[model samples]
Target: MIVDSPKIKNLIMSYLEEKKGKPFELAVDAGCGTGRSTRTLAPYFQKVVGIDVSESQLSVARKCTSHENISYQISPAEELPLEDASVDLINAGLAAHWFNPEKFGQEAARVLKHGGCLALYCFSLVFEIEYKDKSEELTAAFNEALLILLEFHKKVVCEVKAMYQELFSAIPFKDKQRISGICEVFPLTVPEIMSFLQAICSYKEFLEQDKDKATAFLQDLEKRFLDILGESASDALGFHVYYFCLLASKS
Candidate 1:
């Protein structure tokens, strides 16, 4: 399982705690894919339920998760299976962009208790790498490759690029704020970076359209990156990801 950034987890939990107070009773990880973000909520909330539309994803989530307080469920972000006004927090990490805004808003309003909080967050798709003096060169290559992938997933790419400003604005909660430029750095090699990029939904979609072409495209992009990094291709580089978030409270 992918180890999610503790920095991002801490930021989300701390910010929610600040607004709603600690020892939250129930928190839902809406659209929790493979329970990566859901597991992060365990310590802060008494019970953390991970809800996703895909049972296959939920199966992986259940297998990857061991937190006694965490549970998995199959549900949609626009329509939760929980009781009305029963949740303290609803968090969607890298998943809200796919949800129907109006339906999700109503569902959130229905499930959240008075003053309950909703947190939606995702990292920038294109990450920057700091490798000796070749940081800018590698970053440019990544952006170039991302543009190639963008053609296959233009809508998702555009929404993320805008930092989900439209979704954030559509949240019915008047008491809400959008935060941007939260940077988190991780150690990852060039190959690891390539693997991460390929795991994106856009790339997977591209792969489904033409397997050989997609495979060749990714290989070519990896070659370009390796060429740019030289000897540092095998060495772990500082992968810097910027996170944008929307935090809101139910009235």
Candidate 2:
């Protein structure tokens, strides 16, 4: 099991606790990739639906987390299969950006019990990183990496743009909803960093089709990592040097 961080666990739990024992027995995990976040809600809720747009990921969720109270389903954030005023909470971890907030917020409000909370949050770069000595090189690698990430986001820009327009334009459901944006710095080690780069960045896939760009990217990262630590690589990830987290909430 992955170690749960105190701050992250608290952020979610704090909101749930704020309900003051209202019994969050029914909840929804929208965009529940890999069932990681969904499983975390198990102890708090009696019936937790982990919904994702991808059937492939849902299969994995079914296999990995077979809890009796936790169920997996294939559904889009824009339209959920749940009934109105039934669920106690709806969560989107690192996934709200991919959803249409107009549809999502409206759907969320429709499905949730009045006063139900919605939590939107994302994980950011770890603070324990140490790549500052080779400041210029590291900065270049980080920025390039982010640009690549942005390019990935561009894949569904239409849905996102429409979603943002709807949410910001106050065209969503529940006039009594609340929005919150919060950020926190955390730590990550070498293996964690490498896993993140591999799983999330799709670096290997990018390399296969775009060898030249991938070559340039890795070459630059290599130079920076070596520069900061001479022959060996830097072991400590830099502290609070990144902004990889985002949050939006509605109640």
Specify the highest-lDDT model's number. Answer: 1
Show pairs that collide, candidate 2.
127-186, 128-237, 129-236, 129-237, 129-238, 130-236, 130-237, 130-238
Model 2 regions lying over 4 Å from their true place = 1-8, 123-128, 131-140, 155-186, 201-212, 219-223, 231-251
CA lDDT of each candidate?
0.85, 0.62
Q: In model 1, what is the error at residue 202, expressed in angstroms?
A: 1.1
- Which lDDT tens digits does candidate 1 get at residues 12-78? 6777667777659999999998988898788888999999999999999999998999998898898
Which stretches of candidate 1 lie above 4 Å from their native place? 1-5
Q: Considering summed lDDT, which 10 consecutive residues are worst modelled in model 2?
A: 239-248
Scored by TM-score, the top model is: 1
What TM-score would you give candidate 2 relative to the actual structure?
0.73
Every model's TM-score: 0.94, 0.73
lDDT of 2: 0.62
